[model samples]
Target chain A: MALSHDEVLHLAKLSKLTLSSEEVLHFADQLTPVVDYFRELNEIDTSNVPETSQTTGLVDVLRTDEVDASWVLSQEEALSQALKTHNGYFVVPAIFTRTS
Target chain B: MNIPLSISEVQNDLVQKKYSCVNLVEHYLSEINTQNKTLNAFLTVTDEYAYTKAKELDRVITDNPHAIKEFPLLGMVVSIKDIYLTKGIRTTAASKVLESFVPQYSSTVVERLESAGAIIIGKTNCDAWAHGASGENSDFGATKNPWNTEFVPGGSSSGSAVSVASGLSFASMGTDTGGSIRLPASFTNVVGFKPTYGVVPRYGVISMASSLDSMGHFTKTVEDSEKIFAVTRGVDGRDSTVVNHSYKAVSPTQKFRIGMPKEYFAKGLSPEIEQKVRAAAQEFEKMGIELVEVSLPHTKYAISVYYIVQPAEVSSNLGRFDGIRFGNNRDSFGEEAKRRIMLGTYVLSSGYYDAYYGKAMKVRSLVIKDFDDAFSSVDAILAPVSPSLPFKIGEKSDDPLQMYLADIYTVAANLAGIPGLALPAGFSESGLPIGFQLLGKRFSEPTLFELGKKYQAVTDWHTKKPS
Candidate 1:
């Protein structure tokens, strides 16, 4: 059940995080115990119990359509926290670069 | 004489004119100035706002002297946890990203407490983003346990517990996702109540885990805790999850059948805490309450189940803080919160979703069924809130697993979506405080409080003062 170094690295990359070498080593040690704990969940028999997506017994509470603008934040005030911007659009590095 | 009053004591005096709302608030303001030097409890103190509110209360009391007799906790002082929004006030959640940000709208709990006439003196410190079990995770600094400054106040509601225990305020509001409120209450020796999930609206809260995140309070006694719960418990349109019905109060059984889950006391528990829990239950027996033995085999897996379920929800709930719309200071979220977001996202991604989050939900169902079986035979379950008393400041900081283990007793209640109360059981041999929990059926808070108050009457443990 040991996690391979490549597996951990692949997981981090998919998560969009940049972990340092020191953190990798630290997480390598920490994730060992965590992975071992979850191994027990694999052994339980839950065939009789339906997998529950939510515990709330009620289905849904729908609100009627209404046009109420209370406690709303202005657009500029809200978007000001972005790290980068261009032409009033949020800017992030392209996920897949076009080969030219 | 600088005196700090409990909610009950203050309410009675206000009725007798022993002190006006203005006098009580000014006295507490001065106490904060003198005491906060050592007890790093408050994050932002609202001096002028509190004074003006007190003056207004004076006008109301004067105009209709007899007509103004309502839950006069109206004039009482309260502390707010940093995790809630405090419109036009600095609420950092102890994270550096929102250090200078003032939320445009206050959290519903904050707005509700104000309308009730309670003066909010300050917002207290907490673990950044309410992610860690210990206060060591705060971006600002760790809060010191009031009983012994050398030790840490258990968190992420560290300051809320300290302020109530050290007499800085009559009571304080806190959010408990897992053990946030209970752990600190246990460490600081105060009463912490986590009402049944959805009893208090989560609107405007900086949520950690939506389904499991519960908004609750901490106070000097079980009575004050109940009063606060009554004031804030109701439906709010602002929060989609808040329940719409008022629960009728249940008087806990005179011959209450208590459950002592052998699984809880099986292993890894401190002897001192074990003895106190057993002693507290024996006190219940003397009071003619029933004590029954119960088993919850699935209890051992709660921590594993919680870590997985919570982080998965956190992965979704915290998506708003992408260095864009929310947390303005992109780099200021503490390392712990960043680490969790990274870990949570990894588990919930396409490749590993079934292996982690899906399986955890299945296990959560088993945990809830275990509580359902145990509650059928007992009015409530009694167990030690923490395995032991408060540890030294750096004791569990480096090893995250040890810190996570401190939440074992408290997390199960959250997973089961029931109410749990942490009461001061007794003190450790070294004179530190230890706590035992009284967990009850869903919406059975009054049952737990009445039972806890009955125990407090016979034993003076709740009254012991910390130097």
Candidate 2:
């Protein structure tokens, strides 16, 4: 179960995190022991047991289709925290660039 | 004159005109100013906001003295762990990613606490994303344990415990995903109570493990913890997981059956901590209570299950911090946060989902069932909050597994979605405080409170404060 370097990079990408080369090497060192230690779970027989996904026992609590005026964050307030804004809209990196 | 005061004492003093609310707040402010530099307990102090709120409370109290009854926490000061979102206030969650992120809205808990007339003086430091057991994981800086500056404050609710322990605030709110609240409470010699899951709404709290996280608080005394729990526990529409469980006040049983989990005392536990916990449990025998040796066989696997399940949820929960939303890019995550996210990503990945995430979930059921079986035979479970006393600052920081092992006795309560209270049991030989945990069935917080208050009645350990 030791993670390869490429696999670690893939995970970092999937996690939307960009790790430095040193961090990649560091995480590679750290995650191996952690993942290897997690092998303790293999010793236990949990063949037919059900998974405890949500423990609260409440299921699909549907609220009424109405707006609470107080809970709503105003447009100005919502956009206030953004580091970059343009024309009252949050500015983000372009998903697509015409580099070709 | 500057001695530690419980929340009730401060409230009573405010009502009796012993001091004005503004002066009381100023007193705490001055204490924070003096101690925060050394303790590093606070991340952001809302001095202007606290003063304004206190002045308003003073005016109201002057106009009509009995008006204080309307606000249970009238003019009382409290601090919040940075994990809670504070409106218009910079909440870092002790991560560089949200270092300058000022939340647009406050959490429901913050709203409730503020409206109840409690003045929020500051947001305290915690481990980044509530990821580490030691406060060293905080991106801002590690919070020092108030009892001894050189020792690390147990975390990720590290500063909350220190703030309360040092009398900077009457009480402080913290979220316990595993042992965040209790362990710090134990280490700092304060009462930390984690109510049954979903009892307190988690609407605006920065979530670590959604399913396991319980919003709780640290207080000078168990009675204060009970009072705060009464004010904050309820259902919120924003958090769909909240259950409408009514809080029924329970009294300490004269002939109660308290369980001492045999596995909890087995190995890796400090003999000193064991002796302190056992001495506290024996007090029940003196009160005509039966102490049964119960076994939670699946307890050994809790830390493994927690790390797996928690990181999986963290990976999903932290996805919102993608730079485009509000904070910096995910690249700003600390080593611990990155490790958790990557581990989560690996577990939930295509080929490994069933082996890792799925298997952990099934074992989680076994852990929950172990608690269910144990509770059927005993009214509550008593155990040590940590394996050993609070070590020096850098003792466990190097080895992550060693740090995770510190949560062995505390995580099962989170996994089972039950109420657990950490009460000051005794002091170590070197005078560091130790706390024993009282765990009850789901929604049995009042029972735990009853026992906690009862314990505090006979012992003065909760009254001892750091120099």
* Candidate with the greatest lDDT versus the true structure: 2
Scoring model 2 with DockQ, what do you get? 0.80
lDDT of 2 by residue, B100-203 (tens): 99998888899999888899999999999999887999998899988888898799899999999998988899999998999999999999989899889999
Give the Cα lDDT of each candidate. Answer: 0.80, 0.88
Q: Give per-residue CA lDDT, model 1, range B163-209, as digits (tens).
A: 88887887899989889999999898888989898779999889898
lDDT of 2 by residue, A26-87 (tens): 88887888878778998899999999987888878999999899888888888988889998
How is the predicted docking of candidate 1 categorized under the CAPRI scheme?
acceptable
Compute the lDDT of residue B165 as modeled in candidate 1. 85
TM-score of chain A of each: 0.72, 0.91
With a 3 Å backbone cut-off (N, CA, C), the pairs that clash in candidate 2 are: none
In model 1, residue pairs whose N, Cα or C atoms come closer than 3 Å (at least 3 residues apart or on different chains), thus clashing, are: none
Best of the candidates, DockQ: 2
